[model samples]
Target: MTSRHLLWSALGAAAILILIGGGWLWSLPPAPSVTPPLPIAQAERDATIAALKPPKRQRPLIAIIGINDATETTDYLMPYGILKRADVADVVTLATKPGPVTLFPVLKVEPQATTAEFDAQHPDGADYVIVPAMSRDDDPAALQWIRNQAARGAIVVGVCAGAKVVGDAGLLHGKRATTHWYSVKEIRGKHPTLRYVEDRRFVVDDRVATTTGISASMPISLTLIEAIAGRDKARAVGRDIGLPDWDARHESDEFTFTRPFALTAIGNTAAFWARERLGIELKDGVDEVSLALAADAWSRTYRSRAVTFAATADARQSRGGLRIHPEQVASDWPAERLLPSVADRRPADVLDETLHAITARYGARTTDFVAMQMEYPRNRAAQ
Candidate 1:
């Protein structure tokens, strides 16, 4: 063919390809309707709660494990903060190896112990091992440590995509579980023997427990509180945290990559040059749960990423005693870039407020994308 004819043919093929791709994107299912989550049966709740009860001890030992390189902010911190607030367990933050763990979408933290240190201190193993979503699911140190703890009779609780860590450790084989809505398809394909339940924020099968997504951390933490102490104690703690109820109820199907969500993500991500670094000024006694939610939500909005800044480079202790390392000095970012103060706000309220802020800044569709990523039921409350 002549060069002109070849050029024309290539242009026609490109146009056809664009049309086909657009058609498929349009045909993908939209977000599911918002509905009240189906209630978990009382009998099931009782059984599940009972299943997590620790062996007799003065205070049950709980270990929250993460990789030193990177871990999901909310997944690692929320549970630690909540459990410490409850004062029902001896909670220790652990890293796969020594050094501070860099939390994604937000801050960093100095783990109370490394897996090696934990083994030395508590040779008998902890009553519960809390696995947060790490940067990689196949870290050898993490998998082996979890297996050791599980074999030693610890109830393993996997938060969000931490379910994959549990699954990768060969713990969820033939067990019932659930994980982050976005991870379900891939996780299911990887661990085909496990039953992936739906419409549930958390699931428990034998000694292995798994939760839905980042936001599910709050509810799962409360659930663990109940398992360790009692219903009354869990109720009080839940109220203190601004979540009066911590049931395993969730509308999982509602969170998906819809057309609007895709458009917002694509547009926001494509405008990389326009992206901003949003600052969250840190201080001693900051509420870890709220900080996590605020930082996490804002960072997910494609338009910006959250950076924890403080007066000094030293780590500041959160209200519950988790030490958060600041990413930058306060003077590095201008006043307009700092997020509004979230002092005294509960985690759930912080999330709602952040979502509203995201809507105001990037539009409602971007806010929806952030919420969907969290697997949080945002539309119901908004409606």
Candidate 2:
């Protein structure tokens, strides 16, 4: 054969192979999770709780830290709201700097204090420091502050992909940890010395703790409440939040990057012209946990992004006292653009309700895609 013809033949052969490989991958289901069913026994859970107990103060000072520009909504807010509701610890929200924190996929919140301000106020450091996922994993200021808190005997907790920040801070070395399902491989590779445990919503090894994903924040906060106050207090808070029991139990295997999920995300993204800017109303006494979850979930649909609207441009204080800045005036936002009201639902169940609403509007695959993004287990049968 001529050289050109041979080259053409090789190119055709390569194209055919590429198509076959692509088809195979596209047809295949998500890889089965290798996580085991080894549930954390009560004794083990108690031990972890005890390990994180405050060393000195009767009411431990807890700080939930976020980045100024971009922090994950639920990851930063759920813990603050839940812990505040529990009232077991003196909870404060701190930003890495002095500005309103712009949450990913939704809302903006004013933090209670800046890291520098907190440090100045309490020279002894916080009893527990909660880290949420930020837009940039390698923000030098955040990393240094986390490292300093860990060094000062604060039990550091990393929620969701905040594990990356904690790992970057060099505290997860030689510790057993877990993070968002989507982040497991990347975070594990980043911190090879850390043993990555799965099938649990949260993992604690010594003073450093890590959780599976965004929704895991609720359980982890409950666990922290249990650690500081008692199981009874945690349960009381959990019941009030619509979850009667909260533990480390999680079916990590259930959440994965499946073909259907990928297709839904791709399809939604490709149809960007149809994207809508849905608004949720902000008001005094709104549940911050519910607001965060609802806004975060709706924004992840790819079909829509949630924006907050209030009567005025003024900030609204949540039921738990987090200050939320509305994106627009309520009158300015069209009534049609408002998302299905989650205002009537209990704070904890709003996410599930929003998921159902998504399923109705988009489809089950899109709903699952949103759930997977949040690392929320939608299969109640398995639970």
Candidate 3:
């Protein structure tokens, strides 16, 4: 009886082991393929169908306003440059003269279009007319023509003190505007009827638009595109252009405090310069302590760009009944492509370093720093 039971037990154990071993020895189940299915909607099919569809590049004919030399490097070019980065806008260099107009350097832009030449046939031409601030806005004829364009539906844009020309033409009588900070008081004084605002990078008063200057021009024009077209389309254009913080600041108009709309002449320029180069405004006043604080803040925040300095005689300059004396001028980018030219580069396009240096140096001082005249790099497209 014991031998039989042992035999039965041993047989049962062997049977179980055999089953387990058999299971392990057997081949594995087949795995599913890793290849993904193609997208259901054929982009190529859509492209083929789309290729047959008519072209969609309805570019706005942007005509720039006429001014002798009051025009700025970025003022006229920023929008032109930024917009040209898109397929939606064709930047026609419109000058008072009908031929080639000379700019910062050998950048003699042959006037492809002109106010009189184009305006004669299409009196109500151009989807947009951009006015850049010049050294002076004394052209009555030009101002009159601008009023005519504004009277029509053309969206008028001004950069920095370019708003002064729009204001002078009576376009900004009730419209709110912003300009280069230094000219704020004088602009307000002359155009007393118009409401004045300050310290803003740019302001869009209804259809009318204005920017502080330089880089601010990028956002201002892009916003205009958003309004005319759609936000998505504007986004595409901005992205296509490589404008990094393009639509990032399109904040909701929620309950929030904004900057003051009025400022002192020197304080305004100081505030503007500090924000762009030094990255913060100087400490409240125009005295040595505040100046040092501004320079000190600049050096700390922008250690790479700013240099040490002591206040010099030429560090100060006076404008509109105020004294602006900065201790130093410096702010530099890490880029190696931005040194001044051996000879003025054709297209008058200088690199950005000089303007940055001048801006940093003259933080609360003279408002006249030469700007980086942009030459739209060949085929101005996002890399």
Candidate 4:
């Protein structure tokens, strides 16, 4: 063949090869981006089964103490949920008296057993006693009960201001401890002997473990679970609960003790009043408006919750015809007093006016209102 003919023949062969290779590649299935689940190790499977199996003798019993209008909701519920979910302990909510225990942030919970009942059932006392922060500091009876539990060698875990209760009970007389940043000074003042450590999410001194704030309950609970079970078991439980990388050593100083405004917005537009009437109107932008008001009210670090004056605990409609649910109601406002109000959406002047009005109402000082928005049920309340 001539030189041009030979070159054309070679190009044709190369083209055919490229087409054949491309066709073969296109016929193959796409590669997976994610890794497939690995089979549980035999030892891990056995350990899990053992951990989950109902104890023939007695499972590690955890008593979560609740007091009337005292217990912080998240502090109590988070540990209870985590321990129970981990299957490391038989967690029970205990109270000074039998009945509904009112938790902060307008939550009402009934304890599974009273102190007397629990004492009667387990004469040796609880393996672990979890205490949440209370509204009042001077509960002689509760303090005494806590002392008794500690004396009986129960691992006493205090969440947030529960450290005060622990201190008041003489548990932290000389032991190192910590609490919510806002109360650190107060705690140190009251219990001068306590070694108040900061920046730690949870601190363990001897048998007692004190956590920083409401959210710290999670990591601390995982720590407890790890101690009761094993690291693998704890990791498995954490994975099951969507907290696969939880570590107790982690510290949360994000919502430090520095005073932050506790703003609660109240009221609902006609559209927010009747949810069934209008489905959900995004154009009205009620949620966005409320978020804007919240954002503008205080520093992003401040705590706030949306509330309405509607009679029932049902969803409300916003002025923009959006169905919205308020975190609280007027009759059952979490705080003793209400802050000033701000419009949902308006000009800068209006926003500034609203902010000014709120600050003036709240005395210009951004007080720490941690209790107002701390505790909430892990699961949804039954309608």
Candidate 5:
């Protein structure tokens, strides 16, 4: 071959090699680049972290037990309302059977779940079980259920006469406990093993806790909330429910009882005409103190024979679960004339305004009667 033909053949061979190398490079999968991208903003990083985080755990579960004709209204409801308001616990009202549990002072409560249904839903049992004061002491099913809950390592709480149920359940044996002052002797006699402690609002022995009176339920519940959700959370809950700086150790005897009774009498008297106008509805209910006051005032009023008093249009239910049926609805009555039940937990300003409004509407005679009733308690306390 000539010199020019040899040079052309060499260029053709070089071109074939370049084509083969390019085909091999194209056949190979692409490799990821190792270079870092632009730095993320701190706010963007935080938002990403928040978005990827797991959800918070659910609140603790609490089960309140009630019985027919035996359960006291306050004992069952106060804690329920308080715990629910706390927003820390999942509180449920349970009973041995379904339907309304007739409470003392003629109130009735329909429990949310039966024992069987509760067990079915929560096979692990409750974290806390509350037993309210019951009139009847011997309920085999209730007693057995209490025992079962205790055996499963759940916290057991008894309020007032509810301590009797715990005692009967055999949980109170060798446990320090207290009950409603009136039932102290009876409870001690019935449960000889129980060491009855007086003057304390509530006593805690291991997982079991017992409180003294119907009203003691509130503080004890706050204590329980403090335990489950920390002191700060409990205090917040207390403040929300109109109790600020609540301490469970504070005994019920610290307050002057006579003043409440006197106020109750006054409230009842004021409610007389309103009751005549509104009528009473026991199914709707009234609190223990309010009910007592109304009853007493009804007995004393001249119109008591002619006019029947009712709690509310729907038969009002009280905080303690007293149900009263009024003969008429108070909706038509003058707003100032309506006797509103003022609980001690109410803010001083709100209470003062409420009192002023009521007295302003009722005239000086009504205010004079209240002042007179109040004076006796002050004098008695001073002495």
Candidate 6:
């Protein structure tokens, strides 16, 4: 073909292709139209979002630590419930690495995120880091993390004997603290430098908050919730949980917290710490906010039971919410009554007694761990 002919042919083919393509485009069903996201003024939107969400609830992050004396899962969970239910903080579990962390004899909780997984660039940075007491005697990695948390300007609070770990990190050097009365000896044995009001349930020193022990977890959590949220919210949640904090009447040395025994003298400090740290408030009760009222309709019914008041032997019946006979408590168990006030003994005395008894009975659990850690470096003095 001649060059001009070839050019004409190519032009005609191109025209045909264009026409065909155009026809195909026109023939197809109109693509479902997607409304474009409105041109959001980045700065304005950011400002609006900031204002809509109360700044306190957006505390970036809060960590529930794991390590020795952490058997207090309820301590961690109750505060977690307040934080999440109230939505005052981004709660995450921070472990040495990132896996299931065994808590005491019963539970194994996996960390929500690891220390390394924590992104510094996250839009919300952590503002509060809570170190929970572990059941294990010690965990060096978790201790180091606590030191790191303190360095990051995060508010630090220790629940139950977890305070000992914090104190061991030297965070509570001059700070006042309290732990289980049963641990008063070991705590003193482990941290003499830490000031303690053996009777106090919880204590806050500047940026550091410490609890007496497991018993004090709830009260501390409530305190934290109120500090960050508000009294109305805190009270609402207290009522919902049947916290018995109504008149501060929950005070006193001898109120049975739950099924199992605890680490603190009275109030559950972990709960109090969460209450103070994250201001979550949901007022629910046996009435409108019953436990039966699940996110769905298939849940079971519930009750807002009050703490049972213990009555001494024939000490005249007093009118109260729920009365629990002393016999129903330790009074009925002859063995418990005769079990001796061994708790009244000192740590050193107890340790010596334990060692002697163990040596006479089944010997130490294992000698290897003792050899490796015992001589490594203990503060010798509890402080």
- Each prediction's total of clashing residue pairs, residues at least 3 apart in sequence or on different chains, is 0, 0, 10, 8, 33, 49
The 10 consecutive residues of candidate 2 with the worst lDDT sum are 1-10
What TM-score would each prediction reach against the true structure?
A: 0.91, 0.90, 0.51, 0.57, 0.59, 0.49
- The TM-score, computed over Cα atoms with residue i paired to residue i, of candidate 2 is 0.90
**Strongest candidate by lDDT:** 1
lDDT of 3 by residue, 199-259 (tens): 3455655556676644456556666566545557666756544443332121111101111
Q: Write down the worst ten-residue block by lDDT for model 1.
A: 1-10
lDDT of each: 0.83, 0.82, 0.45, 0.54, 0.56, 0.42
Per-residue alpha-carbon lDDT of model 1 for 1-383, expressed as tens digits?
22222111233244345445778657656766657676678999999898889854658999999887778889998999889999999999999888898887668899999999999999999999999887778889999999999999899999999999999999999999999877899899999999999888899999999999888888888888888888999889888878886688787668775667666666776687989999888889999989999998898877898898988888999998888888987655687787987788877778888999999988988888888777787744321
Tens-place lDDT digits, model 4, residues 147-166: 99888878788997788878
| Stretch of 10 with least lDDT, candidate 6 | 295-304
RMSD of each: 7.3, 7.9, 27.5, 24.1, 34.7, 30.0
Error of 1 at 270 (Å): 1.3
lDDT of candidate model 3 versus the reference: 0.45
**Local accuracy of candidate 2 as per-residue lDDT tens digits, 1-383:** 22222111233244345445677536647644545466668798778888878865889999999888778889999999899888888999999889898887678999999999999999899999999988778889999999999888999999998999999999989999999887899888888898988688888888998999788898888888888888899888888787887667788887775666656665776677998998888889888899999999888887888889988999998888888999988665777777766565666688878898899888887888788888887664122
Tens-digit lDDT track of model 5 for 164-250:
888899888888888765467888998888897644567777678887766567667777777666668867866765557543332
Residue 180, model 1, lDDT:
89
Per-residue lDDT tens digits of candidate 6, residues 1-383?
Answer: 22222111233244345445565433432322223223335563333223223223445467777642233444454456555545555676656665555443223345556665664543343566676666443567777767776776666778766776677777877667666544567777777677775334566665677765443555566566666666677667665454535211112132212111111111122233322111111111111111111100110000001111122333112111111122222222233112112223322233234334323322232111111111111111110
- TM-score, predicted candidate 4 vs. hidden true structure: 0.57
